[model samples]
Target: MNSPGVKIHHLDGIKILDLFAGPGGLDVAAHFLGFKSIGIEWDRNACETRYAAGLPTIHADVSVMRESRFAEIPSTVDVLAGGPPCQSFSVAGNGKGRRALETVKKFIHRLVDGEDEARIDEDLRALDDPRTALVLEPLRWLLKAIDTEGRDPYKVIVLEQVPAALPLWEVYAKLLRGGEGRLKGVKYEAECWQLKTEQFGVPQTRTRAVLVARRPGHGAIAPLKATHFPFDLHRGKRNVAQAEMFPAEPATPGGKQRWLSMAEALESASSLENSPVDVSRLRRNGRMEFFVVSNYGSGGDPKNRGQRLSSEPAFTVTGKVSRNKVYKSMAEYEADTSERFTIHESGVLQTFPHNFPWSGNDQAQQVGNAVPPRLGMHVLSWALRGSPPSDDELVAAATWPNTPRTTTAELRDIGCGDQSQCPPGSHKVTRSRRKPAP
Candidate 1:
């Protein structure tokens, strides 16, 4: 699996720079994999959470990080990673970016042609959501590494975003592969895939579009293999092809686990004594099962609210996660709202450590925007090691830091910054990337 000039080093020697890092989800995974990591995030709320988790961070905007020839960037960066703001392209938001796909592609080609920054910025400002143009920032950084006189090109690149961004990722894969336009003979092996969170053992049912690329001479790479079945597949509701492709039970010979459930994740053992939540109240009709009643509508109909069972993964956690109600059964839901998931419980569903300190004003947004750390571990292992982490490693990463829980109030007391000072578009977070049902 070794490649010329791209040999895998001891994990300790690898270094990574994460742009738009939202509360260190990938940074936490990089730590578990023994890679040194530093994240640059403009969001103060996320920065506070990172500090509480003991992750290194550079509190600055990604747009500003490219100044002075990337002067503040570490010289030994081996991996380039980021998740740009996705609201413009998300179905949950207005489809400004999606509508402007052709325009974004033109900008990408302009980057390849060495267009000046001012011209590009001026054109980008014309868009409905300028944040949509931020998706190209990773490519800007990547291209700079190759063009700058003294810098060595990054060996690997990984990016994640809402599924609607997959078309954009496909465009990136082409540019990295190299051909007629500007990246002639680059020969990097690159691929993009839409992956479900639950398939990687996350307790939430969400999907993300991911792109992984290796420099020239690195061996070809493929999408990360799923270690668990999806919610529908585990319930035997999927078609024959998917069923045959993945094992049915955790006990099956292939060793694939069934989809992780909300109850299992929230109730799992953790290093912090206060972390293991007592979900007995969620038991339906005295049975050991629970349900989640979403605050949002199903298919845009307010009367048709969405719901999921405890045996299955929870619905995609949103910035409004605290608004969702958990009930013992349909009867309880119809009678009245039972209880809401606490901030800590909400983080648990996202596969964040139980004790992770949630900080700043909008704590719910902080947790919702994070890349699921468990899923991060799998993806990072695939990019750097060309394989998946062992079951033992995954288990160990889940309990990362092994520290006591840091309360949200405590984080605020320590200068997390005034909520009013954060600008309107400063925060960057992804929304649901799953496909719309027929």
Candidate 2:
């Protein structure tokens, strides 16, 4: 039987309020599908980048401007989307997730225990920075909006972060939907899951924890499927149902889905391997390395050596440039990628528009921090009432710096201050006291 061909639909004028929108990656997807969105951002450079990209933005921190600031938008809004900054919770950065988790847990406990909301407010007000806790701002807005409207305030809420934030997101789902049994006063139904970007047609192996909540009568939140199946990455398009029948790998998606490998994406740069290689002189901040010298810097552990194979999706793009080093293996000449990925290449991997007119002072940071418009498209497409976009539409949204579910409170805290519990091969390596230049 032939799978019904996908017919892309117009966005139907759904509006979105994007929080912590960095460089407009999510907004890019919204635009591709013809949706209106207003992004809230505090970073001046990132705001400049968003404006140059033609995305509307409010230049203010979520804490400062607040969601109420945008409640007056002329258009009716249906979705709220954003991925809070991950530095405070990322293993690559100083591990403040533990401290922030405690405070947030206490705050949630108090709120559910019938404590005065004002007193809890005063306690959180005294918090020191509480950067990791910034992720909670979205939930705060969700509650405020639903109560203020006395109905489903928004059709959907989408949030993404590093794996560490999974627990916090689960906690949020519990508080909002009352977890197992829908509480008497809960506002919506919610679910969370972990999604690998490569499976979703992104040419990268970045994994994120995503949570989706919707008011009753809307679809339930479930793990978004990969448009580009893994087996498809190895071969051309095939029947997706067949793949589903023969579960090859442990977590393989059943379908004709094939991943878009790095080679396919960087075909433009295929001939550039002969150019001069820019190898790092010192080794530090990397979680792994190749068999070269100990000083040769890279990001993963000994097994992967941080080499991003052209045959596979790229490693997770990070603010740290040293994480994903390109490894070119030619018939005669094999070495680390000679030149660094151009700003455009990085944008492509992040699934941004080709050479998106970058206006920010920190080009790398802007690119790395985005959610990839392609990835955002899949999310926004499904988020709309009835999940209207066709499968083809969802797949089209995943070409580059593109960008999913719910897991339990499986986040580790004991060794979280270090990378001890990060994914295999992503722990920090202490080298000579000297630091390396980016």
Candidate 3:
């Protein structure tokens, strides 16, 4: 496929504040959609990567920023976006956040009730895992923006987390839509849904719970529509139970496309060979087919490791993605472990550019944790424009960085520490007082 060579759209005067913005996944999409964005992140490692990529970033703990430094943030934020840390709620991790769901909901109510910050923090500290409380930070920022004098409420809010956080997002949707308590006079159209990444053309089967809220005036917010058919692990054939749960829908021209497969996303695949009848077959596209052997196993059985064909979307890319091995054939798997997916390939599977400048330690972790930029493009288009992104915009996202656009000099550093220690070409981004066109 050739580069789309589409120009980046800059929605003048519209800005985004991204909290816990790891490695600029959503920010990249926001830039593709023509919105300026500043990501607030606490991880020194992720910040290093963000800086290397020329993604504007503020390196600070969000919890600390909330206490005494929210004033440092730029005042004209139309969008609030983030995916708070999800280790506590992730199915792969300890279920501390899952168990504390009721507790977190009560905390939201407390925030709605106008509870003191110190009091809320004190209670949040008592939770089994404090990271669970971080989920509420978006609400805090939203309410503060609404209630603060001289500050307009955010025109829109976008948030995403592991699927387990859907219930929490539903709570946010309810409060935003219902206008309860401090939200009483506020007007927002809100929707929350579980987004399957593969349906949006991400070459992985990750699922995320997303919330998009905007002032009613923008347009009635609609559930993000899928642009591709869902992937079936069974490939072309499905057993009775699978058939019932996931009905097949073939791809058609000018309609939804088939879920993108790993072999299609990565160009480094070895030559194809028909494996055993039990092994999944490659799609008719005739690309070099491969399969993956996960380090981890299904049903917690180490002996029964999970496996997937390159013709299918990959299993959810996790922080330990580097440990998963890829093989061109069953013979290759039996002989010895083949090479693992590179960090760049993993990022591509997550719908980031093949040439995305990744830096810092735990690079795999950064790619694994990112909100798929293509998925973000869909959600952001729905939130801001109340429709799916145009084909040109989609092509732009896919063919990002046809040429480097944002130079380090153009970025306005916000809340970054020690200008003397800052990287070369660092500068401040200032905005005009004029509001964006509605």
Q: Which candidate has the highest TM-score of all?
A: 1
Question: For residues 1-438, what per-residue lDDT tens digits would candidate 3 score against the true structure?
Answer: 111221122212438999999988889888888887878887656776776666767777786676566775667577999999999999988899999898899989889877787888888899998899999999988887777778888989999999999999988888888887877578688888998999887888988999998888766776777877786665456333222343234435557777777776665222222211112233223445677888653555657788777657788888888988878777777897587777877777788866677876889999888888999988887887777778788666644452243443233233254443333444344666988889
Consecutive 10-residue window with the lowest summed lDDT within model 1:
3-12
lDDT of 3: 0.75
Better of 2 and 3 by lDDT: 3
Predicted candidate 3, C-alpha RMSD? 10.6
By TM-score, the better pick of 1 and 2 is 1
lDDT of 3 at 335: 91
| Candidate 2, residue 190: how far the Cα is off, in Å | 0.9
User: How far is each candidate from the true structure, as Cα RMSD in Å?
Assistant: 9.7, 14.0, 10.6
User: What's model 2's lDDT at 342?
Assistant: 61
lDDT for 159 (candidate 1): 96
Assess each prediction's global lDDT (C-alpha) against the native: 0.76, 0.60, 0.75
lDDT of 1: 0.76
User: Which stretches in model 1 have alpha-carbon errors above 4 Å?
Assistant: 1-14, 179-186, 233-253, 269-272, 284-288, 297-302, 402-438
When 2 and 3 are scored with TM-score, the better candidate is: 3
Q: Arrange candidates by TM-score, highest first: which order?
A: 1, 3, 2
Q: Arrange candidates by lDDT, highest first: which order?
A: 1, 3, 2
User: How high is each candidate's TM-score?
Assistant: 0.83, 0.68, 0.82
